[model samples]
Target: MIGLTTYLERAQTGVWDLPAAFLPHAYFDAVVRAGGIAVLLPPQAVDDRVADRVLDTLDGLIVTGGKDVDPARYGAPAHPETDEPRRDRDAWEDALLRRAIDRELPFLGICRGAQVLNVALGGSLHQHLPELVGDRRYQLGGGAYSSAAVAVTPDTLLADVLEATPSLDVPVYHHQAIDRVADGLVVTATTADGVIEAVELPTVPFGIAVQWHPEVDSNDLRLFAALVDEAARYSAEHTARHSSRTRHPEPAR
Candidate 1:
């Protein structure tokens, strides 16, 4: 099973405003395309016990893209360009990543998910990209994707999955990006503009995060497939461990 994170949004179905958990179908499509069961995990209060109990049941996790991570988390004031705070989602996902480190669970972070992943690892964000780049090469329009080529570090997990010299014209949309990468993670790819595009934790079997939305791209499902493939292995190993424990029951007094 794969757990995909979702956020709360206002959906107008009737004449009243109601908060609802929502996510794009592409997320579920990506998971299913990779031969895994897709389950959307809604944003909730920060409860470690609840997080652990729920997470322990899933083989992998995909932190979906959404609102910006409150700059307060990385010790920065909110930038005027930053989106409204999604504190509940931020706290929820942060807690999940914190627990993920110990479980050695597979994680694939996308867009805002990438930012949260970095912050959860004690890293910081730029808060706003336009200020640093001095141009809008990362995101073309307001929230639409702008195509750019990314140079992959040879022999890295990203390079292996991409299986080519450079990733060509991947969809990108963001105003904030990774600043000081977590010491635990290594840079795997970057754009010609020197912006961080991908990262992975060497300590874990599969801890990968990308700044762009791979799930949004209908042409390539490599990133999602890689995650699900690793997740399947995790599920198999976990089941085997459980079976062994059940067969060799602890002796009763």
Candidate 2:
């Protein structure tokens, strides 16, 4: 099963208007299309123990796109363009990510999810990309996606998964980018402007994240398919190990 993080935001539906734990259908849709079961992980009070409990239930984890991560996480003051702190979500995702990393869980990050991975691993964010890039090319506003030509690094997991030529035009809609990349992450993709577009944890079986919204591009399921394939392998190994333990319990003193 693929555990996908979600946005805990206020919503309005028939005869009701209240805070809800929901996610865009597009994310789960992509997971299902890639041949995996989708499980929603809404923001909640979390500790390492709680996070591990959640992770123990799934074979893969996905940190989906959403509001900007709080700058305070990386010892930086908030930028004028930064969104107000989503403390609950931030804490929840951080704990889960750290635990996921420890367990080497197969995972993927999208947009803000990528930023979280960086910060959780002693990295920082640019806060306002337009301010640094001198234009809003990454974010065109009005909930519309702008395209970016990202060059994928050769001989990297990202390149292997994408099987891309040299570069790919991807849908992007973010105002921030990785500033000081985390120590253990390998930069796997970048744009013409030198913006970090993707990173992967080389130590893990399958840990990759992209600044672009892969879910938005319905035609390209390469990334999702790669994740699902790894998740299936992980699940199979995990199940076999558990069965072996169950079938042959250690002798009691």
Candidate 3:
């Protein structure tokens, strides 16, 4: 099963307005198309034990994009443009991700998910891309996506999945970028302007994240497919390990 993080936001339908835990269907749709079961993981009361129990039920995890990760997470003052803090969601995802890494759960992160992974590992963000890049190219207003070409570093998981293409034009819509990369993470892709576009935890079986929104493109299932492939392997190995433990139980003193 592939567990996906979701947005906890207020919404309106018909004559009612209320808070909801939801995610764009595109994310789960992509997972299903890639031959995996999709599970929604909404923000909630969480601790290490709660997060571990959740991870125990899934073979893979996907940190979907939404809301700015409160800057207080990285010990920096919030920029005027930063979205108001979602303390619940931030704390929930942070707990889940830290434990997920410890368990080496096959995982993927998109857009804001990328930032969460970075900050979860002692990294910081630029906060406002327009200030650093002198333009709003990465985030066109009104829910529109802008395309930016990024160069992929050869010999990385992203390169292998993308077939070692020297560069690719990807759909992007974010105002923050990774500034100080965390330890145990490797830069895998970047735009010409040197903005971090992708990163991967080399120590894990599958821990890759892209600043671009691959889910935005209906035709591109390469990334999702790669994640599902790894998840399948992880599932098989997990089952075998469980079976072995069952067949040969350790003696109790």
Give the top-scoring candidate (TM-score). Answer: 3
Candidate 3 collision pairs = none
Error of 2 at 26 (Å): 0.8
lDDT scores in order: 0.87, 0.94, 0.94
Candidate 1 has what TM-score? 0.95
How many residue pairs clash (N, CA or C atoms closer than 3 angstroms) in each of the candidate models, in the order given? 0, 0, 0
lDDT at position 110, candidate 2: 96
Model 1 has an lDDT value of 0.87
| lDDT score of residue 159 within candidate 3 | 94
* Error in Å for residue 87 of model 3: 1.1
Model 1: residue 185 alpha-carbon error in angstroms: 0.8
- Displacement of residue 233 (Cα, Å) in model 1 is 0.6
Following a full C-alpha superposition, what root-mean-square deviation does model 2 have from the true structure?
A: 0.9
* Model 2 spans with C-alpha error above 4 angstroms: none
- By TM-score rank, best first, the candidates go 3, 2, 1
lDDT for 82 in candidate 3 is 99
lDDT of 3 by residue, 191-214 (tens): 999999999999998999999999
